[model samples]
Every structure is written in structure tokens, then in C-alpha cells.
Target: MPEQVKLRDGTDTWVLALEPSDRERLVAGFEELSDESRRQRFLAPVSRLSEAMLDHLIDDVDGVDHVALVLFAEGPPHVYDPVAIARIVRYPDLPDAADLAVTVKDDWHGRGVASALLPVVIRRRPEGVTRILTEVASDNPASLAMLRRLGPTKISNTTPGVWDIEVDLTAHDLPQPIPLAVVPPEELDGKRLHPVLDAPGRHALRTRDLICPWLN
Candidate 1:
């Protein structure tokens, strides 16, 4: 079943796991994001999601024992910054513990979209996730303040306009706890180390495919 959270506005925001059915809505929301909003929310430029790209993201979702939550706007998804979209992925590996990402539409900023979305993330922080990491452009004081309110742990300047920050998730101050579980690698075989024995044909295939393409 998909996870969901109800906003204070009496509307419901659904957090669907990364799946094929959810890709269209996700891509549409991402494409609708304005450039300025994209700059503020992301660390880089993000064009609209293509089917292939969506497939790759979904694949990543399955590879990790992590959950990706989509914030719904009255049953629809919303867009965040393009450059910083990876913030969601990095959330799972934070120095502290938390499994949450915050993203807001450009036109929706200062309108409580981020504020409304934060609690949902806090509630969803994994069991042992007592520390959260975030990066905000130094010029973007508003974002820094938002993250600080969650709890000020550490701040380091990455660039003139970017600051990396961390938030601690001690239960005394917060509600949820992150589960202590680590996903292990799927394989550890000699075939992986001794590639020639496992797949001698692969070497010929690579040489034929790449060597001829370069020659042509």
C-alpha cells in the first residue's frame, strides 16, 4: 500500500513508492517546475523526466532498501528544484539518521508547501535516523532558516552561496526513529573477481562493439 499524509489544509498528500504507475505524475510535476524554482530547490539543472530516466530511478529505488516518497498536491505531484533532486537519494546515507527529502514547487514557495511537507518527512524519518543533512545556497537564507528550525547541528560552507548543514534527530526533540538495517550486496562470487572464466565472450563482445564503432 502507498503511504500518505494529510496536510493541515484538509487536503491529502500521498507518498507513493517509486513505481511505474507513479512515473507519469512525477515527470509531469517535474516538467512544470519553473527555472528559478528549479535553481532554488536543486543543486543543478533538471529537465523533464523521460520514460527511460524514470525507469533508471525506479531501478535505483529497488536496489536500495530505501523508500522514495512523492508529495501530492491535492492528489497530484509537485515539482522541486532540478539541481538538487539527488537530495532525496543522499537522505538515506546521512551521517545522522533519517530517510526524508524536502522539495517545493517554485511558485509554491513561502506558501507553506515546504513547511507543510516537512512534518511528513520528519514523521517518516527511518528508525535510527537521528541526524539529517541538507545543503542550502548561502544566499538562500529562507531555506537555511527552515532547516535550522528542524535542529541546528552543523554548517559548513561549500561555496560562496552553498552551505552544507546537518540536523540531529534525537528522540527527545523529535518523534520518529530510523530502523537499524543495512542492505547487503547481492553477490560475492569468484566469477565477479575472475571475469575471464565467467564470461570470456563478454571481452570479445566489448572489443567488437566498441572497436568497430570507433573505426567507423
Candidate 2:
């Protein structure tokens, strides 16, 4: 069943598990983000998501190591369009932790699209994952503030322009975590989001950082 939500602005939306068939919708959603939004989300001036990048994003969302939710708004009558997606990719070596990121279409900004997704995402996170990890660009204070609201968080500057954040998922007011169907990575297969490998003291790798897979 799809989860329905009413935004703070009195708009109705539905939240559902993102599936492989939603590739076109996912692509469309990325096209809707502003340059600054892409910068804050991917930590780079990503003008386009190449085919390889899209494959990395959609191919491994197994509801375990990679769990994701898409939020959609009603269009004409029964039609629904994706407005945002929130996802976590579990660390291959560190099963109890997952890297997190949320992307909302630029038009839906300040409308509580994310607020509606976070709790459901939390309640349904992969088993043994008690922590959520992410790196927010230092310049994006909005994301920084949102990270603070998740739970007890440990945050620090891993690089000159990025803030590494880890939020205690168990500390949040959500139901206990459950064991999800595990999907073993054939190898250590995740995109490195931050350009720097020398992020001294960084807790987790950017698991979905294939923003520029070809360059890597």
C-alpha cells in the first residue's frame, strides 16, 4: 500500500517504494533539480546524470543494502508524479551503518516532502543499521539543519567545504529496526561522493557518490 501524506501547504502526496520500473521518473526528477540543489545533493556541479550514473542509482536499490522511497504528487485525476526520493545505501563492510541522501524537486521546496519521507524511511531501514551517515556541503545550511533534527548526531568537518554527519538511527523516535533481505555487494561497489579520499576521520564512505562515475 502507498503511504499518503498531506503537506504543510495542504497538498496531497503519496510515498511508495521506488522500483526498477521508475527509471524514467527518476531521470525526470533529476532534471527538475536546480544547479544549486544538485550541488548540495551531489557535492558537485553535476550538469547531467550519465547512463552509468543512472544505472548505479537504480540498479542496486534492493530494499536492504540500498533502500529508497519515492514521494509523488497527484496530477490529472489518478496520475501521480515523483516529487522527491530519500534513500540509504548500507556500507558493505559496516552493515550497521548506511549512507543517506534525500532529493526533492526544486518546485516542491519548503513543502515538507522530506519531512514526510524521513520517518517512514527510518521505520523501514535495513536491519542492524543503527546509524545514518552523510556528507553535506558546508555551504548548504539547510541540509545541515535538517541533519541536526534527525537524532543525536556527531558532525565534523572532513574537508574544507564538507561536513561529515552521522545520525544515530536508534536514537530517533521510530519503531525498532527489522532484518531486511540482504543483498551482498559483489565487491566494494559504491560511488565515492566526495572528491577527496583523504577525508581524515570521516565515518562512512559516500556509498552512492557515482555522480561522476566515468571520471573515476
Maximum-lDDT candidate: 2
Residue 12, model 2: Cα distance from true site in angstroms = 1.6
Instruction: TM-score each candidate.
Output: 0.58, 0.77
Model 2 reaches what TM-score against the true structure? Answer: 0.77
> Candidate 1, which segments miss by more than 4 Å at Cα?
1-18, 48-56, 62-65, 75-100, 174-216
| Model 2 per-residue lDDT at 32 | 61
Lowest summed lDDT over 10 consecutive residues: which window, candidate 1? 207-216
Candidate 2 yields a Cα-based lDDT of: 0.65
Which residue ranges in model 2 land beyond 4 Å of their true spot? 75-79, 172-216
Candidate 1 lDDT over 1-216, as tens digits, reads 444555566655554434545445555556556765555554445454445455544444541334444454553445322211212332323334432345555544565555655665565544455665545555666666666567634555544555555666563664232211221223211122211212333212111101000000
Judge candidate 1 at residue 116 and give its lDDT: 59
Q: What is the C-alpha lDDT of each candidate?
A: 0.44, 0.65
